[model samples]
Target: MTTPETFADLQIHPAVLQAVTDVGYETPSPIQAATIPALMAGSDVVGLAQTGTGKTAAFAIPILSRIDTDNRQTQALVLAPTRELALQVAEAFSRYGAHLKVNVLPIYGGSSYVPQLAGLKRGAQVVVGTPGRVIDHLDKGSLDLSHLDYLVLDEADEMLQMGFAEDVERILADTPEYKQVALFSATMPPAIKKITAKYLHDPVEVTVKSKTQTAENITQRYFQVSYPRKMDALTRLLEVEEGDAMIVFVRTKQATEEVAEKLRARGFAAAAINGDIPQAVRERTISQLKDGTIDILVATDVAARGLDVERISHVVNFDIPHDPESYVHRIGRTGRAGRSGTALLFVTPRERHLLASIERVTRQKLVEGQLPSVEDVNAQRVEKFRDSITDALNAPGFDTFRQLVESYERDNDVPMADIAAALAVLSRDGAEFLMTEPPPEKKRERPDRPERERPARKVRDDLATYRIAVGKRHKVLPGAIVGAIANEGGLHRSDFGHIDIKVDHSLVELPARLPKEAWKKLENTRIQGILIDLKLERGGRSKSDKFDKGDKSERSGKFKPSGGKPFRPKQ
Candidate 1:
């Protein structure tokens, strides 16, 4: 039989084909073209394809076509290596089968199991989950594969590499022999080969070779910053870096919202999108990005799959990806169709190894990025302030304000320049026109000296010390503290000063007078699964020492957005 060229030509259900058409996909990718037909024939199939090769749809479309949605007994099971991928696959299934009203459930670690248990009880036709979570459900007798019609092991190589081989086998052993299995992997290692040999019965093989190289038209660079200071670094880059529109890639769904909120607080038009967001909202946000309503999008890896925006001039890896494939996938979001794009990576000291792995995999060395100096940022601010002035001069309805200023100048016998300077200060909205404090100099590395012997970080006077109830005993790290504070308090690195970890607790330096809401959130924030119980240090002088004890309606301080027009995508 001749192979099908279009998705409609395949044996896909009309609903699935219609959904594909709605997504503007008329042609199937190589992997999709090959694997979908084989799976539709009720044959076990093994697919070899790299990341971003339409592998998810390759299996999802066929699986959805064959789903007995009316049965609603967990007919299909897809095993993924990570929570993000599981959510991605679940979302794809949901989208593809929307017309058929197929129920898809995604379960993973680091999330509450109550929802999963409830979902399983409510009944879903398709269940996509991580190996560990799948095994957990199997142990609890919540997942039954006895009547499963389709079994799929997506990213099988990554699952094995992440030490889930035994869990994969355990799940495989529990499934009925009649289940049609589909295993997809980027490479054929012994571990993956063994799983296919023992499990898949007369499986047809499909291999889709990658048609393009990694980041050919992309310029890549990395900035080495401490964990707590990543936000500070990111802020400086946003101020000085030249880009039309940007997509910041973070690791978690919560981080997407957190980072986007922080960016908005700093006067950037930003939005967050993730698997947790409703599909309608996600689509609307993407549409806004395309129409230049918002210039920056904060997203997780899975949430950004299949995203194609021609105006995205920059891609920022706010959190370095876990694998090289993810790094390639992220950078590929920009620099499309022979266009040049820039990819920036933020690397902490501990994540240098991951950076090295990515460099080796991509066969390209990432140039070290130079953080914009204080003077550079000040110059950018000055230019923005100048533009604001020029805009006021050209805009109507400013005649009254101009006359008022003129009268004040004449009445006080003040020079026009001095009057203008005073007015500028008042018009700044509490943001500094010039940065006074320079960033701390990076410490020199000494291969000859041990880490314990390095000099202690200097504390700045602007920062007030607070104590948190986590330390070495709790196995706390600086990154954990930074992530907890940034994610929970919505505070950035500029709001932090220094950290001194002790045995039972740790001392962290923060803004002397924080907003009441932030203080309350920080007090209850947990690090390493323990409440931080953050408190102001005794004898410390500040505008308010009564943490969370003051009037709830009042706030002591807030970070101010800089004066400028919100960023817009270039036409």
Candidate 2:
């Protein structure tokens, strides 16, 4: 058997091949290119590849190619380490063979078992199940693998780590001897290699080149925001961005639909692509996106693969991806064909370390992106309104509309500007108007500060500074910041001033010499999903830079400034 370079080069069934063509898979992986030919010819295979390298498809292609659609009994079995991975693999099977009309089911714990038993009784051509759930089905006689011709051990190392190795071994023992065994693992640890030596017979070996993740062309960016203000931030982003198309990625399918619904409710052309969509409907939604009928697509990582719409110039990770490779793939949906694209990741306070891990993996700094100013959003909205009016006036029947407006104005004793203002107010969809004045182009007259001027202090050097990890995106009001310090940080409202919140961080001024007990209490508390981060102030930097590494409050050296006592809040 020879290696396959493309999906067509493999001996996949005509139906599955058609499905692949529909799903946009052109090239196969190095492992897939190497192992497909042998597996299609009924030889066992042992493939070693790192995570997020498309290892699922290397074996899936061959097994689906070999399954007998007419028999309907299970002909292929895939064992996964976790329920999430199991469902993800099962979805891949369905998406690749939906046009072929094959039934694929994923069995796992923490989900209803009756549906799985019923699905197996209905004759599944392929079954992907986690260990405990699979064994449960096996004992109940609801699942039969006697006729199985192919078996897949995916992420075997993870399964063993999760204490599923014994169950997997038992499953392998129960599977028919003539079955083709395809084992894939990221590492060849002794236990895994021993299982490989025992279960697979002189298997063809294939290892895909694990490319350097550090070289991924992802321009990672994060906006520090609180949970409550996330929707507002996202809406503001949608209002100002000029992407050709965008996909907002979330962690869950429900999140995909929820975010999509919110965007649609705001009148954007958006849709959700998830596991729950019917195959035909999903194809329709994708076709619309590819052709520009849709502008924003909300999808999970697994549901978004092969979504190679070249017009997609933006990828918004509504939540940070679980792993760096996933970040690569999610953003990889954009930035294709040598075009520059933008990827914005939303990082919660707890998820900052995850962002750091991604940076360490990819070796890139995700520059911080500012949440669009209310002025920016208002400008965009006004421009859009102008464009809409322009479109209407440019139409053939606008002369009639003009005449009607003139007549109404004459009869109603209204000035044209008044009518226009009314229309503008009517056009707004109950959103609050931004009334703050933009700064003048040139500097206005102001008193010059001394070159040696000290930073502003609250109440004659009674000021102390506390860093909070929250910012504008959390919908945290200035009053909330003030109150948190007053009630929680044990400072009076008059003792705080010059509050500022950048996208990922916030800062407030507090009395320098807080009561000893109050300072001690403030040191350990968090506020509004952010660490209170109360500490003495020394320097000034960008709001983002100030808390970039978090606050520097320590236990021993920590004290009130100017020989004052440590402040502590009461119980």
Candidate 3:
């Protein structure tokens, strides 16, 4: 079969093709070129491709091309590993099907069920969700898969690694046997092979290997920034950067607008574009960007997919992407057509791992970027102010202002320098022309000393205790509990205190006051397919007493596997 060059050659729906054109994609990617035709022909597909290889569009375009928009039954189901990826995929489907009025819903844990239930009730043709939440909705009878035509398991390897294997199997069991399943994973492990062997029916395999290197024309760098200081850091960086035009990539639609609004308030000519924006408005925004009406454009990854503008000399990843493929795509927006460009990534302390992942995938180490100091910003402002004066002196106008300054100095017997300083202050409009020294960093207060140095038996009020329903019988380790909570609950290791595993349950100490987001995530957190059912233990036996009086049987360090085999611990 001849490889298709353009999206128009793929026989996609006109509406989807137009949307793709609006996004500036003229040619189909290798994955899309190969996988779309197979999916459209009613064949189960196994796409072996890395993230950021346009996998979403490969399946989404074909699904949209064949979807019956008139039938509101859930026709397609896409399962992703994380909430962020689910949301991203849902957004892509929505953007591509905007003209068709397709309803795409994203369901995930760590969020309220009210909206998802309502969306399902209203009948979204396409449903995207994490495995756990999808199972929750399915068991509740809110999600119906009887009419499912397509099922896509994206990042299957990552999902399996995150301990969603059993959940994935359960979901697959619920789907209709006749459904066309498309499984996309970077690496086909033994487990994934087992799944394919048992489930998929003579699937067509398509593989696309990305260049394991970043573009040579782009200079990559990153700044370690805290969440609260991101806006300040961005403004300072913009003030010092010498780029003609730049694009700031954020993770969500709301963030695109929020960042753009903040940038505009800081005197930048900025605009925002996301999937929610109308096609006409999006086109106008892109046109403005190209014609130099806007200098900084804040956009999401989907919104910036096919955008190619020569004026864009810089790309700022305001929110680090969830995967390395996305990082490559975000930076690729700049340094296009063999032009030299700069890409800046903002990595919060918690996102250092993601930064490392990008570095490993791109095979290029990113230089650490330093935030402009207060002195540096102040100096830039002073230099710009002096240049403005130089330009005014050379201009033909401003004669009246010059005469007034002279008259004021002569009449008041004041030095011309004092008059000029007073005028300069007025020109600043109540804002300081030079910044003051930054405030000192606040020290975190600890009671009695650090947790490590403190006595383990000490029960501090700052640490709250919680209980979970997995223990030695389940072969659950303290590290497992910590890993589950830290990854799913979004809690830091320091946020956890002591973990004491009992025969059937475990007790853990956490901060007394947890962030609202973390608290929500913990509510739905699971360990080895069992919901933790986390509940605060306000009145329990003292932890020290419980530790001193341990159960003899559990202390023997012996356990039985679910297969009824006695397991002995290493000495």
Candidate 4:
């Protein structure tokens, strides 16, 4: 694989070699150059490469080449640590095998099982699944791996941290002995090191180190915004960050398009780059970027390679790149040679762990950048607008424009101030650019229940109470109960009265003489996608049911019961 500079030098099928050329990859990265030959030789490999260094393709190409399409069995298995990473790796496989019509299935938690089971039934050759779900399928007799040819463990260290080690071993135990084993990780922790030592047979190791950024010319900085208002902070930063050109990186293609479209809509020239774009269009877009037709390029990791723009003055990760190596390559895009450049990274409350990783890699703490207010963007815009007007007034061609303005002033009898204000009006963005208002404050949450429960007001003396098995958090407005009764129970709205929502249950007023069939219908009806359950409400059952006391949920059904979680609907 290291014999020549191009991917064609590798001992791969001609079709795969041609596909690599079609994607415009002229040189192999370090990991690709080293690990690929060993894999193609049918030897096991454990690749130690950082994120964003073409690790996906390193194992992907070999797996695709070795898979036998005529054999209708699961020939390849790729296990990722997280669902997001699993989906991302499966997408890479699909994109690389677009001409091959290879069927790759990505199975993970969070999604339903029916579609996945269906894909498996259709004779998919490559099965990518999380460890826990993969183990579940193996136990269920659905995921047959007796015919597996290549087994890849991607991000092995992460899977162990997420507590998937037991499941990983169980799944690996079922693979055929002759299968080629490949493991890739950012770091070789003790656990993964042990697993590789036991399972791999004379595996060749390849490590690709990311070029350090502090050694380069880039100056890195970070700003800590509180949990609620990061969007406003990014907007304020973008206005001041503007220069000849820039590349803003987000986590996904949808985000790239969204942030880019918003920037363009706000009058800055911005465009997005991602893998979905056709090769011809992506090349043309990159060409336009170099020719000064585009001022800003918003992109994701895999799409922004081979970018060498002299005009790029800044790089913004609108969202933090997935790993520290990604962070280095992103900032490295700017600050070439001895040129000074700036990098602004955005992090959220939950992602502070990732920030810590970046600091460790760079060996320097990132200085926080101040969040700009609305006045900041307006001041910059007004300064530029005024400069533009001054330049036009001083131009050699100003005499003609001045004559036209003066002619209008004389003929229309308009005051000069009025004319100037009119001209400014046509240029202002809704005339509020100068009237700076701070971004809207997030809503302060009010306590859901009263500090002290009110004394039970008797709707019927010595009456029976029924539990609705739902609560305030379900958006169960009082009108829903009133209408459900009036429509289904053949009663007027006045037939029902006061309703109460407790920590996990609710109570509603109903006539004592309600019939059994109607009550059964009421109990079975699903209100807002939640099945209604009618039961006796006891004044002391809250204490008996351990309503806020234990880890056990009130309803433990087929899936893990989520008590009082917010409602999510299918799109």
Candidate 5:
């Protein structure tokens, strides 16, 4: 078998070839080389490749080649798990199909429907959207897929993991049975295999092996800290680490903004990029990163897809990802183009299992790193301060400033060293040049109470119980609540405790020392389209009094329970 060296070797459409050339894609990735030909041959494809493996082009190229420009009906429909991925895939289609007269539209939630409806009315040849949004358009009859010839599921495993299996199935069912189906995923779990078995017709399976493990040319390390101390640990690390550019990956969009805000408050040049940011602003953020205006980018996984910045010298996993593949993808943003990169993962003590899983997947043992001590931070700060002074001494127009300083010293009868010291202090603007000493670790004494006699009514010392409005009546399951809270609060599964589901509400126990920001996020978050209405339980309140008799007016008007009735526990 002859391996194709270039995209043109696969006999791509002349227009597509031109677009690919314009985009500077000199050679196709292994997945693209293998899958594009198979797809262009009109065969169903199952592509197994990781996130950064160019899977979008693998399907987009062939889809663009086969699209009928004269027929404006939707010919290809791409389903992605998140709006970010959907927009990215749509952009790839538009970019790859630029030379060809093809219309591509991206329809996703969190955006107005007017443009999507108008695009569908204008007859886009390719439509990309999330499963739920796609279903909405289909039900409204705004998106006509009766003539759809191609269906592609990008990140199929993520879609399933996010509980989109039913939506995906329904969307697939709506498509023409004879239409070619292509499913691309990082991993082929049993669920994805089942989807392929049911929907694909003798699909051509193409697996692109990742050539490099995450550990290759990357210095991987982890810091074990309690949840409350993660922010302090991260800030300390950032102070001492050497990196021209860095990316900090958080789990939630809210965390991205919160972390970015905190970093900025500490006088760091940081920006947050998440799904909520407009496409134009996101592009500008990336551009600023590449051009050195921004040194730190705090982002979520979905928002950082396809981000390739040569200057990114470090990747910080501010929050451990849900899966090992996502960890790989996050760190892969750095250590590119034969450059060495540093990846620091912040793992709470309870999240050690996830850390172990990542190590197992990367096939490298991560070195447990310590937080930079106060002394270390002070030394670095002093060194940088001296360097700044040295640079200023050599800069142009320094003589005039020096003359003014000398005149002041002579007039005030102050020593030259004192003036220099005063100027240095002024330069720092009264900010602490050194970190305060970390508090001594305190040993907890065990309670004298007998283990068997411990009060059942009392909450566990390590667990804090909270009440939520959604429960079985709202079709809320324990797993659903856990998933929502964990994702929203940027918490690990172990961070939660027993979940008691009542008729109209649920009680969940989370880590007692959860940060105030995380608690606020959990309170404001929603599950199953209803606000969680989460509140810390007070002592001596009857369950009925807490749920049924709660004042509805106290809650935010933005979110309400399904019915006008207040939440009530089962009798």
Candidate 6:
């Protein structure tokens, strides 16, 4: 198949083409080049591409081009997995269809439904929503799909994984029989294949394979450290690395703000971009990053998509992503436009398996490296200090300041050298001139040591165990539990301890002195649609007295837990 050189080459409507140009899209991506024509030809399409491949516009442009502005009935419906993604898609459609005068409405949970009802009443031409809420509207008969001419499923695999397959099927069943359907997924699993076979008719398949060869100009490295030491290590690296701009990728929205605030407190020009920030402010933050006002940006994966800045010279993975594809996408923000960039991955000891998985997928071994030493940080600081003085001397308006300083020196009968020394001290303020000493390393068993002779692990005196109401019965996994708590409580994954899952309850260890606010939030948090009802476990007895006394053996490493599971620390 021949590739289209630009959006215009695809023969899109002039109005939509002008909108695309206004949005600064010069050329179509591979997916856009392949899928746009098929979609515009009134054929069902199956798009296979990864994130950040410009898939939104591939479908949006065609839908906008084909919409009948005179007919206000809903002509197209797009379903996404998350509210953030749904809003993002809606924004894209609005941007690309601005000149076409098409009305696009985004309906999702957590927002008032009044606006959605009003939009439907006004006869919106396009609707974008999540599957569950879409089903809710369909059940209420408030949403009309009889006139819907096109249905597009964005992130089909993610929707299915979020347990929305049945909802998707039911929603599809409500639409007209002749309505065109399009499915876009990052990976085509068996479930997705089944859906395609059932819903689509001779769909035009377009697969855009990701570039397997990792960016040759990008240097990749990894550092092994515990969770408590991550902030210090990151600060040291920031001091030494020579980058015009850097992006730090964390796992949660809360972490983004916390990390950015901490960095700013430590004297770095940093800000955060997350879902909570208003769209206008997010754009302003990006503008600041581009213009060199903000040197560091801490962001989550969802908020950082489509972020293209030529000044981004480094990408730091503050927390490892859950999947290899996400890791690739996070690092892909750098090393763009044929420029060299640096990618740093922070891995705990227990997360080595994830590190290996990333290497296996990327087909490149990352170089193991140590954090910058205190001496290195001090040296860099001294260099920066000298450069600042040199710049001040070369500045055009320094004569007035120099005369003032000289006058002060003369009035106080102070020598010029002493005056300079005093001024330098004032400039330094109370900030530390050197980095703190590195934390002591934890000891581990040697490969040659006999199993019986190895030392027993030391018990943590600072941690306290708590019992939660939901467990194996609710189909909760260790990762899910950890993720929920860490994300909601603003704690790191490594902050968790042993997680013992029982038939109806689970025991999780966490820091004993949690903040009152975090404790309250944990009490109200839910897992798998079940309320946590978290309570402190005192002397092997829960506050509710639900746990069996005999389970003490299981908790103390005597009798093995279910499935012969040994006690393993949380990653």
* Best model per lDDT: 3
- Candidate 2 residue-wise lDDT, 20-109, digit = tens: 888777998777688778898889888888676777777887777777788889999999876667878998898777767689999875
- The TM-score of predicted model 3 comes to 0.69
Per-residue alpha-carbon lDDT of model 5 for 278-345, expressed as tens digits? 98999999999888677789998878976899988889998887678789888988889888899999
> lDDT per prediction?
0.78, 0.70, 0.79, 0.69, 0.78, 0.78
lDDT of 3 by residue, 228-258 (tens): 5677777777756667788999865656877
- Expressed as tens digits, the lDDT of each residue in 1-571 for candidate 1 is 6777899889799999988888888889988888999999999999999887899999999899988878969899999876667878887888888788788999876566799999999998899987767877898999888889899999898777655676789899998888899999999999999999999999999998764357578999999977556666777787777676789998756568778877666666789998678989999999998887888899987789889998788899998986688898888989988988889999977679999998887878899989887788777766666766777786787988889989998899999999889887665555555655535756657457676796755544446888889999988777566656753564554456677889999988876766565776566566655988988878654342211121211111111122335322121
All candidates: TM-score = 0.73, 0.66, 0.69, 0.61, 0.78, 0.75
Per-residue lDDT over 1-571 for candidate 4, one digit per residue giving the tens place of the 0 to 100 score: 2255778787776666767777778788888888778898999999987777788889988778767777778999999865556777887777667667679999875456799899999888988877766876787899999988899999897677655676688888999888899999989989998999888999999888855556446767787764334445655665555445688887655557766665555445668887557779888878877776666788977678657888677788777765687788888888877777778887765568889998888777888777766677666556555655766667797888678889999999999889887876654524344424545656546456676976445343212456776677876655554444433333333335466766556787654444454565465444444766866566612211100111111111111011322111111
lDDT of 2: 0.70
Instruction: Output the lDDT of residue 459, model 2.
Output: 27
Candidates, ranked, TM-score: 5, 6, 1, 3, 2, 4
The residue ranges of model 4 lying beyond 4 angstroms of the native Cα positions read 1-9, 94-101, 109-122, 132-142, 214-219, 224-233, 250-313, 332-342, 346-356, 363-379, 387-413, 426-430, 435-571
After superposition, candidate 3 runs with Cα above 4 Å error: 6-26, 67-71, 95-103, 110-115, 221-236, 248-311, 317-322, 336-339, 345-360, 363-378, 391-407, 426-571
Q: After superposition, how far is residue 342 of candidate 2 from its true place, in Å?
A: 2.1
Q: Please report, as a residue range, the 10-residue window in candidate 1 with the lowest summed lDDT.
A: 547-556
RMSD of each: 9.0, 17.4, 14.8, 16.0, 11.5, 11.4
Q: How close is candidate 4 to the true structure, as a TM-score?
A: 0.61
In angstroms, how far off is 293's CA in candidate 6? 2.1
Q: Write the per-residue lDDT of candidate 6 for residues 479-550, one digit (tens) a residue.
A: 667655754454555457788899999998876655565676566566776877878787743222111122
Highest-TM-score candidate:
5
Candidate that beats the other on TM-score, 2 or 3, i.e. the better one? 3
Candidate 1 residue runs with Cα over 4 Å from true position: 1-3, 110-115, 212-219, 224-229, 275-293, 335-340, 348-369, 437-439, 442-571
